[model samples]
Target: MTEIVRARGLVKRFDGLLAVDGIDFSIREGECFGLLGPNGAGKTSTIRMITCVSPVTAGQLRVNGMDVTTDRRRIKATLGVVPQDENLDPDLSVAQNLAVYARYFDIPAAVARARSDEILELFQLTEKRDETVDNLSGGMKRRLIVARALINEPKILVLDEPTTGLDPQARHLVWRKLRKLREQGITTLLTTHYMEEAAHLCDRLVVMHLGHILAEGSPQDLIERHVGGQVLELRIESDGDHADALAALRDRADLRLEDVDEAVYAYSTDQNWDPVMRDVASFGKAARLRESTLEDVFLQLTGRGLDE
Candidate 1:
């Protein structure tokens, strides 16, 4: 696949504060790429640069072989952006919203109507076409916002925290639509703190922290490389030889232990847990063994949860 977006030594600054600290990454055509991190991790700043909303302080940034610095107009023309905050026009009806946005791209009125109808059907918002934006539910509003972004039929879809504030069913519905778009060869770039969203939608992702890229790989690959195959979570108790149990587990070369607030997480590459379980039976009151996921990998690398 060809590279649709590329950055090398990218830097962003507001006065003396460095938001994106010389990061480098690339997005291939038709693949869903993600920037996974907590807020203030430069995910939004990076997206702003690519979308031509902010100037890059330094380094090279390109989209579809065009330089971001010199080709802002050309770049913006081919990109569909969904911002973190809702920006839909509340006074306009759902169909009217899409029609007005299409005019921004200089799309013909007749063609815009055809495209609007097609996109509304794609997002399952056809029934809400004539309803005013203010009358829609949160999920309906989100779907309409997404539908409006596609009014230009852009080559690359850029979403910043696409599923933020959505309920489970609504989020899942949006996820399904995004997956369908990916299958149709629309390249996607998204910024998200939702571990499951990134794991489900992104083909590759970079873990960002304090405006730096900490790790980059497929979700499963990152999990295997950082946290391992299985995780054993044991609640730490002040009484009953818990410290001794921890010390015993630490003695084993095969286990990696991470101590968070009220629990100790044991990571192991080996699938078998019988031996490890025996060592914790005496001290642990609540123990859970489960498959390691992107969340575990993030906690291991960042020393914090995604929301923190």
Candidate 2:
């Protein structure tokens, strides 16, 4: 597979604060790659460098084998970006929004109109074609924004938290549209906080925290590697009686333990999970055991701190 985007020792800083601290990764052509983290985890900063909107502070970043510093225009020409913020022209109708954006790529008037109509139909927004951006529902506006990004049929689509604030129905619709984009072999770089979205969409992904990549692999691979096959959450009622039991639980059976707030998260393989839970019961603590997930691995590496 061709490497469409590559970064090595990439760094970004603002007023002496390191935002992206020397990270390395590569993206293959026609695969969906994800960047995931909580708020302020440098996800947006890394994307800006990839999109050539922000200059790299240090190290090399190449898009389509061209350096981002010198070949920004060329790189951007092949990129279609849907930012976390809706950048649609609120005053223009849905169809006009796409037409105006198509001109940015120097698309011919007739071709722009045709592609605008085509993508509108593709995103299921043909009925809202003549409606003003402000009149459409949040979901319709999101569809239009994604449709506008494809006006130029860009080689790479960069989506930053595309489904952040949408309702469940709207998010699912957006997911369906993104799945279609993937089926079209679009090389996509997506940043989202939703674990389910990452697991469902990403072919490969890296977990980022504090400007560093904590782990990298396919979703299931990362989960199995970092978190084992299952997670047992022991939420002991912090009524003083469970303290000794919790400590004893931690030392039992060579288990990996992460203490977050009031919960002691334990990781065990599926083959040993039943016996592990049986051992925990001897400590007189009630625990809930379930399959380990990407979220479990994320919190384990990044901690439970709220990034606000």
Candidate 3:
């Protein structure tokens, strides 16, 4: 596959603080790539550099084979960005907002109007095309932002928390539109805190933390390699001497133990959890089984829960 975006030893700094510490990665043509991380983890800084809104402090960064510093105009023309916060023009109508945004690229007035019409229909906002941006709901505003981004028909789309504050139905709508863009062969770069969003949409992802890459792989591969397969959750009356009880279950050598907030978590590769239950049964019946998830992987990797 051809690499559409490549960064080697990329670094960014704000005053004396490092926002993005030397990181390297690439996005292949037509692939959905994700930067998964919590806030202040350098994901936004990386995106800003990639979009040419901010210059890299060090290392080589290329998009569509053009160096960002030297080819700012070309890169900007080829890229579309949806920032985490909506920056729609409140005074303008939805259709006017798209039209004015497209004009920034020097699009013909007739062409901009046509594009706005088509995009409004695509976003299911044709009925509200004449409505002022400030009157629209949060979800409507997000969809309008996406439609405006697509007005340029950019080869690369970069979204930062595209569904951050939307309702479930609105989020799914955005997902469906994104899937359509993928089918059309647009390379997508996404940065989001929602793990399930990354798992469902991204072809591959890198987990970022503390301005560095923590792990890189497919969602399932990361879960299996880092979080184990099946997990036995025990909410005991009291975990007094639970380590001794856990030691008795050494017959299953594949399991790893974790104790969190009065709950004991037994992780194993094998799906059969009978042996673990039997061992914990000696203590009490409060133990239960839970399927492993990417949340578990995130928690294990960062030593804290994703929401924390």
Candidate 4:
């Protein structure tokens, strides 16, 4: 695979606090790679260092084969970044924001105008092209930010929490756009707390926790390796005495179990739903079983929900 982004022992520190401890990873060209972690996991700090907005305190970092320290300007020109926050110029009209950013790349007026026009239409922002940025809705502004990132026709795209606050429809729309970009072979590196988003968009990902690498692989590979392919969630109400039954079932299946407030989770790769159902049923109607999801694996591994 072609290497687009590479980092070795990357580290960052602020006020003597190690925000991003030594971590190493790489991104292949034309692939959508993910950085999955909860808040304060150093994902953002790593991005800032790789993007050259902040200096790395230790180790080597490269983007598009250029050294971040010596080739900062050149690397910046070849990359596009969309921060988690919307940093749009509120005073400018929607189209003008892209126009201005295009100019930052030293793109000529006529060409920049054409590119802006094409992207506005591409993002379905043509209808709002004349509206002030502050007047646009959150989703619209987000689409605009993505459109602006493409103004440079970058070789790699970096998105931090791209769909954090979007409604379902808007989130799906963004996913469609990203899929199109993947089809066009633009390498993308994304950081998000949403497990579903990572599973849907990332071909491979690295899970980070407390500035350390926990696991790395394709979403399906991680699930099959770290988390089983199938899971059975059971909620039982046994008048405050549920440990014995839960422990018996957990050992019988030889599965990992998680004890939440009112339920115990069982996970296994085997495709025998009947056994899982029967096991729960043996505990009486107090047990309820349901299929597992990516959300379950994330919580199981991280000990915290994605939204938390």
Candidate 5:
């Protein structure tokens, strides 16, 4: 697949503060590429530069072979952007919102109407076409925002925290639609802090922290590389037995431990967990063994939770 977006030594600054500090990454055509990190991790800053919303303070940024610095107009024309904030017109009906946004791209009125109907159906918002934005539920509003972004039939879809603040059912609905879009060959660039969202939707991703890339690979690859195959989470108590449990885990060369607030996480590639489990059985209230996930990889690489 050809690279649709690329950056090298990219930097962003607001006065003296450095947001994105000399980073490099690329997005291939028709793949869902994600920038995963916590708040202020430069995910938003990097995407802003790619979408031409913010100026790059230094380094090279390109979209579809066009330079971001000199080709802002051409670049913006081929991009569909869903910002973090809800910018839908509250007074406009659902159908009207799409129609009006289409004008910005110079889409013909008749063609815009046709595309609006098609996209509304794609997002399952056909029944809410004539309803005002203010009348829709949070999920409906979110779907509409995404629907509006497609009014231009863009080549690359750029979403910044598209599922933020949505309930589980609503968020899942959005996820389903995005998956459908990817199946139809729309290259997507997504920035999100939600581990599950990134794991579920991204074909490949780069973990960003404090303006730099920590690791890049498929979700499963990162999990295997960072935290291994299985995780054993043991609740930690202040009792003397807990110290014994920690000491026992440290004695084993195969196990890696991370001590969080109330839990001691044991990571290992060994499938035989019997010996490890017995050592921590009496040390805490509970113990759970499960498959390692993207969250575990992020915590291992960053030494903090996603929200932190």
Candidate 6:
């Protein structure tokens, strides 16, 4: 696979504070790559620099073999962007919205109309073509935003929190469309707060926190490497005796333990969970265990604390 985007020591700063503190990564063509982190993790800042909407404070970034510094316009031209918020003109009709956004890319009127009709049908929004933005459902509006981005026929599609506000069914629908785009060989770079979104869409991803990459790999690879195959969470009651319970398994070198308030999370790799179950049995009915997930790896690396 070809490298579509490359960064080395990529840095972004604002008023002397470093937002993206020198990160390095590469994205492959025709694959979905994700940048995931909690708030204030520089995911958005990095995206801004990649799109050339913000200047790089230091280091090098290249998009499609073109330097971001010298080829800002060229890079922008090859990229399609879907922002986190709905920025569509509410007064415009569905078709009107795509036509107006297409103009920004300097797409000709005839070409824009043809593209809009085709994209609308592709997204199952053809029936709502002439409807005003206010009348469209939340799902329709989001699909429209994506359709507008495609008006330029970009090689790379950048989506920020694509399904943030949608319900389960709507989110699933968007995921299916994105998967179809990937099948068509479009490179996708995604920044999302939802862990499941990243897991489902990305072939690979980097977990970032405080402007640095904590880990990078496929979602399953990450889960296996960081948190192991299974997690045994032993929840203790608020007034329960945790010290005595922890002492039962303290000598076991295989368990990675985290004490979050009254909750005790024991991440283990031993697929044979009988040993861990015995300890949980010691804690009576206050304990339970289940399979670990990508979110577990994220929280393990980035922490459970809320950022602002």
Off by over 4 Å in 2: 269-271, 282-285
User: Alpha carbon lDDT of residue 287, candidate 1?
Assistant: 76
Alpha-carbon RMSD of each model: 1.7, 1.7, 2.3, 2.1, 1.7, 1.4
> Once superposed on the true structure, which residue ranges of model 5 sit more than 4 Å away at CA?
269-272, 281-285, 305-308
Quantify all predictions' global Cα lDDT against the true fold: 0.90, 0.88, 0.87, 0.85, 0.90, 0.90
Residue-by-residue lDDT tens digits, candidate 4, 1-308 = 98899999998899987888899999999999999888988899988988899998999999999999899899999988999999999999998999899999999989999998998898999999999999999999999999999999999999999999999999999999998998999999999989999989999899888787778888888787765777766666764446755755665655777777777777766556676677567667556555455666667677754533
Query: Best by TM-score, which number?
Result: 6
* lDDT digits (tens) for residues 101-208 of candidate 1: 999899999999999999999999999999999999999999888888899999999999999999999999999999999999999999998999999999999999
Model 5 TM: 0.95
Candidate 2's residue-wise lDDT over 149-225, tens digit each?
Answer: 89989899999999989999999999999999999999999999899999989999999998999999999999988
Q: Give the range where candidate 1 is weakest over 10 consecutive residues by summed lDDT.
A: 236-245
Error of 3 at 93 (Å): 0.3
What TM-score number comes out for model 6? 0.96
Query: Residue pairs in steric clash, candidate 3?
Result: none
For every model shown, the clashing-pair count is 0, 0, 0, 0, 0, 0
Error of 1 at 219 (Å): 0.6
Query: Please, what are the lDDT tens digits per residue for candidate 5 over residues 49-110?
Result: 99998999999998999999999989999999999999999999999999999999999999
Any runs in candidate 3 off by more than 4 Å, and if so which?
A: 239-253, 270-272, 282-285, 305-308
Give model 1's clash tally: 0
* Model 5 lDDT, full chain set: 0.90
Q: Please, what are the lDDT tens digits per residue for candidate 6 over residues 1-308? A: 88999999999999887899999999999999999999999999999899989998899999989999999998999999999899999999999999888898888999999999999999999999999999999998999999888999999999988999999998999999999999999999999989999999999999999999999999999999998888877777754567766777677788888888877788876557787788668677777777788999999999999987
